[model samples]
Structures are given as structure tokens and as C-alpha cells.
Target: MAYLYYGADARPAEIPDHVLAHVKVVAATKLRRGESFMLTWRHRGEGTGGRTSLWMQPSIPLRFVFDEPEPEALDSEYLRKLANEATSSRGIVLEWDDEAIVGHPGEAPPIDAMAA
Candidate 1:
């Protein structure tokens, strides 16, 4: 699990590394344009399991820590969708789906399996 240390206080927001990578890109693009937005995601794992939202601003500090040594291979298709959603009233999302994640047991499925 990767942690997103947001703002000065630095509360770690636990997220899957791949998902965080996508969010990082979107946040950077929007922030560079001087746009402030909200990032919302439901809590995973054993906890209250509701959601958390952060106001992402250009000036605020954000640190993305990955457990994996290598950076994730980004999916442009997902990035485009996420970027589009970030511009909406709903803001950027950290939710996961088929493409947004690797696969069960942290291993990507074979192409043939995916096709099925």
C-alpha cells in the first residue's frame, strides 16, 4: 500500500500505488493550471470504511510514497478519464476498477484471461 501524505499535518492516505500514481498526475496537471479541486476516495481495509476528501491546492504540500521501488506504468486511458472527472463538480476520484488496478494477489492477469 502507498501512502499519500497530504498537506502540512501529513496524515497518510493509504492507497494502492497504481491508483495513487494516476491521481498524482491529475493533481499535478490541475495544480499547474492554478486550479484547486477536491480528491475523494472510499477507505479500504479494516476500518470505518467511509470516505475522505482533500482540497488539493497549488500551494499545499503532497508527498506520494510507494512501497514498490519502480514507478507504476500509467494507463493513458484511465488518466484521460480521471482528468475529465477532476474537472467536474465531483472532482478527482481514487476508486478502483478492472483497469485501475493490477489484479488479484498483486499480479496482472494474462492477456487471454483479460479477454475472457
Candidate 2:
């Protein structure tokens, strides 16, 4: 499965509902705005011998996926909720590094690189 990483905070599971909603909104807005950007993150862990962490950031091209597109109207309440969520998220600001290995499914490639 493909994964989306939010680097600023580095706590994926701790994202609040409001922030998630805002992310969806931001993604949708970016798609509408014709803006595509790369998000990167790092993974750290300890193996049998020692501790290690790798900085592997991937660049992804995101397109708007609309089953039923909504009108280009921004809901104030929703926007506020999203803003609050983003504030709470406090995600880290990561520099863009376009060096990620794409991974594919149904074929076992390297255990590290994932299909884009």
C-alpha cells in the first residue's frame, strides 16, 4: 500500500479529525489550484545490532480525485475547523528532496522502495 507522510509533527496516528479533514480540503484545493508539491519524511528504528534512521523523502504528483466534485465554494466553518486542525497538528516543515524510489505491487522489488 502507498503511504502519505506528514513530516512536521512525525506522529501520523496522532492526527486529529479536524486536521485530517483540512488536509483533504487542502489537497483538493491544491489540485484545483494546479499546485503539486513534494513531501518528505524520515524513519528511525533499532535493529538487532544498533539504532538507525534513514531520511527518505519522496516526491509525489497529486491530482484531484473527484467522484462527485463539489462547487468551488469554501465553507467558513469547515475552513475554521481545518485551520484549527492544522494548528493542532503542528507538522514539521521539511525541505523538498526529490529522491525517492518508486515501489510497485504484485512484484517483489526492494523492501525499501515503494510504488508511487
Candidate 3:
């Protein structure tokens, strides 16, 4: 598991290491370009019926912590899909998948899924 610490909030958002890795790349890219977007995701299990969203911007302090000792290689296709979704008005929604942490845009799976 991984956690994303945003702002001064002590409770970090829990995420899978692979998922956090991909989100870190996409978020970094957008923040570097001075773009802001919303990152939405449904809560795991049945407790929270509503989804949560974070307003990501360049000014906010963000940290990514991974449980694994080494960082995973990024998938370009998956990153592209995330970036594309971030640019949309509705913003990006993080979804969990068994095959890959980050879901592909279309019918095709990520080209480098096995590498990650």
C-alpha cells in the first residue's frame, strides 16, 4: 500500500503502490505545467457511499509514500489516459483494477502492463 499526503492533513489517502506511482507522475506533470485538476476516487469497501475528490494544484504540498522498496516503472499509455482525463471538465477518477492499478482509456489494456 501507498499513501498520498496532501497539504497539512495527517490522514493520507491510502492507495496501492502501483496506482500511487502512476498518479504521482500524472500529478507532477500537470502541476509542473501550472495546471490544476480534481482527482476523484471511490472509497474502498462499503462504508463510504460517496466518493472523495481532491483539488490538485501546483501550490499545494504533496507527498507520495510507497510500501515497496523500489519505485515501479511508469506506463506511458496509462499516464496519457490519466493526463487526458485530468484535462477534461469532469477531471480524473481513479479506479482500481486487478490487471493494472491504473485503468486504460479504451478496450485495449496498457502496453507496458506486465513491466509495472
In model 3, which regions exceed 4 Å deviation?
97-102, 105-116
Check candidate 1 and list the clashing pairs.
none
Candidate 2 has an lDDT of: 0.32
Question: What are the RMSD figures for all models against the true structure?
Answer: 6.8, 16.2, 4.5
List the candidate 1 regions with Cα displacement exceeding 4 Å: 97-116
Q: Which predicted model would earn the best TM-score?
A: 3
What C-alpha lDDT values do all the predictions have? 0.74, 0.32, 0.79
If both were scored by TM-score, which would come out higher, candidate 2 or candidate 3?
3
For this target, which candidate reaches the highest lDDT against the unseen true structure?
A: 3
Q: What are the models' TM-scores? A: 0.79, 0.27, 0.82
Arrange candidates by lDDT, descending. Answer: 3, 1, 2
- Better candidate by lDDT, 1 or 3: 3
Q: Model 2 off-target regions past 4 Å?
A: 1-14, 37-116
Q: Which is the better candidate, 2 or 3, if ranked by lDDT? A: 3
Q: After superposition, how far is residue 52 of candidate 3 from its true place, in Å?
A: 0.7
What's the CA error at residue 97 for candidate 3, in Å?
A: 4.5
Clashes of 3: 0
Question: In terms of TM-score, how similar is model 1 to the real structure?
Answer: 0.79
lDDT by residue for model 2 over 1-116, one digit each (tens)?
Answer: 12234445343422223222334564554435554433222432345332222232233333222233432333344444333433343322221123322220122222221111
Candidates 1 and 2 compared by lDDT, better number: 1
Residues 2-56, candidate 3, lDDT per residue (tens digit)?
A: 9999999999988888778878888887898899999998887657667889999
